[model samples]
Target chain A: MYKGARVETIVSISWETLLDGVKKGNVRSLARIITLVENREPGWKDAMKSLYPLGGKAKIVGITGSPGAGKSTLTNAVARDFVARGYTVGIIAVDPSSPFSGGALLGDRLRMRDVVTLPEIFIRSMATRGALGGLCQGARDIARILDAFGKDVVIIETVGVGQDEVEVVKAADLVMVVCVPGQGDGIQALKAGIMEIADLYVVNKADREGADEVVADIGGMLDISDNGGRPQPPVIKTSALANQGITELVDALVQGFESGRNADSWQAQRVKEEILTLVETEILDYLRENWERTGDLDKAVEGILEKQTDPYSVVDSLLPLIREASRSKETT
Target chain B: MNNKKIRVLIAKPGLDGHERGARIIAYGLRDAGFEVIYTGLRQSPEQIVSAALQEDVDVIGLSILSGAHLSLTKKVVDQLKSNDAEDILLVVGGVVPEQDVASLKEMGVAGVFTAGTSVSQVAQFISEQVNA
Candidate 1:
């Protein structure tokens, strides 16, 4: 009877039930809980608090590259390999949200058709959701949810626009930056910022002409850059479409994880960064709500439009009011 | 804190090879300030319901051009009910016939849009249903 009631309450599932389902490896329950946390539904924070300790068992991998670099196909190939190796893989494919409508055309699954049906694999597409750094606000939390749900490996694929792509480094234990042939100066372009974040560099579509040139370019760039006493990231060549080089890439990823296992300092740093990000998002949200409720935000905008006060000055004046609001909320 | 943007899933269920209607509706919903997630062609009822639940969408607009709306929509509706997700606003759009509109509504689909229906009409209907 209790089991029937539990089955009947799927739509309005409680957090306790969802948590139990997650622990038991129920895909539907895991998907539902991901929605709850992603949407920040009521009691979401409590859910996170309960699930956090259950995480830390899964290996998180971040894959990123420029648009049109075949990131999705590469992810699909890698996922298939992981599944073959007896690992439960969770994939988070991030796509850009339309700036105008704030909606997203998440076509990542189209390229992932091959691995979508695998019983051990779960693939989810995410929109940037106005989060500037190639990832959504709840992506890390979602990854944690997958971790706690018993996935052995969780892979996050970024939207792959430069600079913003670096954000994935903070969330993954190993970050793979993928590049392709025929872009000519593309390898050189990546040298500035993105090259540094790579735990492994993959030259995808290696069967195409100019693949070796891109590989050499990356190798040349890696040699020139100062690693500050750390070993340079390995560069692997792969044609994801042809199902080549994926095993080598996955092996390197596993090796990277093994080497970094005892790196307590990096783990601590990641936790600190996570905490700061959460606090920053929450405080900004609180400040925005307070300003809007007090009508100060609208007033400031009006003043700026009327040319009565400059934007910086408006912010300066509103700071005290925001501070006061924070104080009052704390006391209450 | 309740300024949550509406999320809608525009899914193509069954083996409908033609996706022009679904694509158009996805674009329309996005332009209307809703976060729309488009699940491409050849989705099963189970896949559609799973996507909706995972996405936590407020509204699900099913686009079916293949004349199997009754069975497909019924399967999706039944899955939603079993999952306790019947509260989600279920709307269908495509080459739906005038005669079948009442039956779709009877099967728990909130609204049905047929040929010649403008994108704004569908968007407005969804907004009203969600807000209501």
Candidate 2:
């Protein structure tokens, strides 16, 4: 915060203080370190690498659905339920940011009023930050930080998503797809991508007229979809606002907490996806860092702008740098 | 890209239902390319402090129209201090009496934007304080 100090140097020095604070159960420090990682400050990966071993204990949950599906309310109910049963909870509630402004009015806390003051629950409001998908990798990293902080469960309420945003699958150990009545007919349940990602389905707002029908429709879809070797996904009915049937939902989540350890059918695929994502990020970072410093990127841009060379040729020439770097990596 | 964008928590810390001012500031801050966390109506100061800590926001902007600015601001300031987060710059925006502004600043609020202050001015002041 000093006027002349470099942010990164401050971060590097404070990272220890942050880590020590987290270890000592300082909530403010835990929160600050989360910001450090979420913003991906320099040395962030090192911080994660240091804390990674302390993770793998807490269960991560992801809740996603169309806008107004009561994701936040249900998250509040579930987190409170978990805490009542003697488990600490962390929640990451995602809301969409304005793509134009790169800013967001994160209003999830408005719906999560009950848990805001709970000592057992740590709620964080996050914006999608132009991730295309409604979820961000940073959300998962924050989940890990919470796990390392010893929370028994971490729930990620994805920005009310559409039918195709499946990024939550990459992050949560258990994915709960929430559905409300009167949104659409059963056909809405059959959409290809999001339908396939549900570990459990909640017919939220069950007090409404069409609740059981929605549950039945999802149940019918589950019956038709080939199970292969996977267990049939369960559909539970709950009214998050009425507080009815919440215990059943919590029961399902707690059962998930146990079965998740056995590597549910999606675990292997999720790991592969995560590693691929990390590889893509790392490779892009390497090229951008190297090219910007070496001026090759600028040279390519200049050639393209001057119409002396095309992007195809530019990429063809630049691809070799990656090969050389990989070869060097292998040799070392 | 590694540079930290100032994250501001715009919270309403009393029972006042007038949320238009907070919404305006939230939109303004967002348009300024800052990550703004908008916790809606009637936030208790404890809740405000908790949200600030867990979100690790760079600054906290409380919007008050309940004529309880002094007491509300003091509670927020005291809670933040007790939580060891006094370093997070605090600001107040709303119908503050001109006479109460000095004491609000004395309570560690970095800036106070009374009615009619431009959003850009508030944003400019925040960036100067946080990104300096």
Candidate 3:
């Protein structure tokens, strides 16, 4: 019995089969392939190359906010509404990974129980995986996979911490910055970083006291910031627990996407960023691999420890090797 | 690579309201350098299996204290087989008797940790099984 199973394992699942399964909307296949690409498993690049063209159909929306802003609840409400509108939704909730253990406690999906049982909704919880920008590089790839898997909308939720979180949300077509009452000082501090990334400002937990004040604070900030004469992003109040203002939020999101549909320049800029990121990651990986293969990295570290060569001089010495590695990779 | 951490999904099946064991195991596994995805309470076999697939977890540790271990484990194992994911290591914990451990093993559970099993012991079992 185990012999046949061992043989099957030896012959890994083919890319064609996985791609066909994704096209047919098989959730298992979609899930499996997403894991493959997210881990950058062997042949992952080929898989992504095949699915890249099939994406861009789904409307990508990003929800980001402070740790206690009820981002997950708001995301759940928005996704539920999207499903009710006869659209399939995919959600990516990102949590921080532990630097010490290289592990993550992905509890965001627990808060999203409301939409988990819905057949039209697929929720995936991801760790930042040591990526600096609040999201792993695989996030964009996973979003594309979800888009290709036939979801009409994909929501990327990140814990808004710093510039990294803002950079993560910039990948979305519509970005919502969530604020809750009693976090006035926190929200005010974030206005310089996260506030600028919002295409819409959502005052979540509107049932709490000072909800109106928070909304007003956001409005006041918008008045002060010069938005280059463009219409200010609308600030909407929502109680995710009570499910208030979700419809209005959805409508605003749809209108936002509609109005920005013809903005090819913005889309081109996003693509440009994505391409640069991809190149940077690939080149770095190649350089590391080459250095490791040649024992140069260890030698360089030893030299630094011995104070034989300064850090800048070490890098200068490594530059020629890195260039040679890049050339070799290009030829291959 | 050697640095890659193992991912585990600790799921509670069959409407078990008790979550202390699962929570402890989740934290323990995380501290042991495993990315643990905890599915909270009251998960169906389908939900558990779907999560394991989507997360690409190397191990699935089901915490069932509702006396439905045999049936739930069978359903989960069957679902995993149907999804071509039988290679995933499966474990069971919570209120299990020695007599039923063999039965669970027969149903494809790799290990069983009853009450009083240390978190490190459970983590060690999982790490050994997955790496093996």
Candidate 4:
């Protein structure tokens, strides 16, 4: 129905239909809707608009740890526990995009063959898309979509590479930092990023030789970080392969979610971010629609790229042109 | 074989950070002619789902060596289903036990590759599934 109108009208119709399907707990529809949104097609905003009101019912749990700490196996165990308890779960697994190929190689489901077929469970894989923080905003958006779709628990898994992992810590109601024994720095490396955000610390692969030492290291680090005001994060040992300590880990998750004040803080932060995202969408839409019409944005980009003007000056020049166009449109 | 690269998203869900396997898989898949998106460690289920959707990937592979695999994969599958991405061939590889394999498959997982499994087997399986 839309003819070269910048955005597709089918996307909007399908989006609304998909939202309706999701609200009804239709699995196929849920998957399709997510695909539309994740692709960020022109009409994704419309689908999100329809689905946004349906989200936020889900409890978001974040699990992070250092590389080689068995976080995925731990997450798999926890997810099984949640399902056993009769909760519909959603998972958001984050990975870094391949710089060379611009595509992703997401294998979070590799170990989860048995669980992935559960009719009640939903899973989605996301990429950083070169976002500054490791936790991609696109991931957050899809989480909202899943939440809207009536998932009882939403688990967000991040690749703990650099600041992005820390950013994920900001979004979770309970942040579990998974660690293993025998890393060169032990829990010391975690002390900087993983330790600070943990509601619970998991010493995974506890069957390994240095499991005890890893736990002790974490204990020592926790002792040093006893800031008095913050409740000390608990450390539990588990061999995800052996299915050891998963129940306890789930218990800790429940306890942490039930007790954390920071969850409320995160809720507020998410709300603020949602507002900013909507604003960003509108601004970009406006720029795309009007900038070309006025022929000013191209000039600004050219000026900035050509070194004839700095970014700040380009923005300064572009703002007045936009303002004048808006004023003219308002009068017209 | 047309030699078309299969784009894959290898992600870590929740807070599980054992990424050596994930990294190796990423590298291996890339070498096998699959465009691998390896989000270099510690990712949320939401982030993972979003990435797969954006990239229009044929498969979404999760590497969760953590015991939380049940919860993480369930969440990813649930989210993918919720977004109409149930067809995206969800596969998991890492620290998985034999007993839980059935349950994971029951949850819509197409494949489960545990430790000692050859990366080529994975790449080949993915190739067949995506092609099919």
The prediction achieving the highest DockQ against the true structure is: 2
Error of 1 at B40 (Å): 1.8
Error of 1 at A85 (Å): 1.3
Ranking by TM-score: 3, 2, 1, 4
- Give stretches of model 3 more than 4 Å off: A1-11, A132-136, A186-192, A261-264, B1-5, B81-84
DockQ (CA atoms), all models: 0.31, 0.59, 0.47, 0.09
Please, what are the lDDT tens digits per residue for candidate 3 over residues A24-53? 988867877877676676788899989989
If you assessed candidate 2 against the hidden native complex, which CAPRI class would it receive? medium
Question: What's the CA error at residue A253 for candidate 2, in Å?
Answer: 1.3
- Chain A, model 1: TM: 0.92
Q: Tell me how far the alpha carbon of residue B22 in candidate 2 is from the true structure, in angstroms, after superposition.
A: 0.4
Lowest summed lDDT over 10 consecutive residues: which window, candidate 1 chain A?
A: A1-10
lDDT: worst 10-residue window of model 4 chain A: A1-10
Ranking by DockQ, best first?
2, 3, 1, 4
**Any idea what lDDT model 1 has?**
0.81
Report how far residue A195 has shifted in candidate 1, in Å. 1.0
lDDT accuracy of residue A325 in candidate 1: 59
> In model 2, how large is the Cα lDDT of residue A129?
75
- Against the true structure, candidate 1 reaches a TM-score of 0.88
What are the runs in model 4 whose C-alpha is more than 4 Å off?
Answer: A1-13, A132-135, A188-192, A226-228, A277-312, A319-332, B1-132
lDDT over C-alpha atoms for residue B12 of model 1: 89
Each prediction's whole-model lDDT (CA)? 0.81, 0.83, 0.83, 0.73
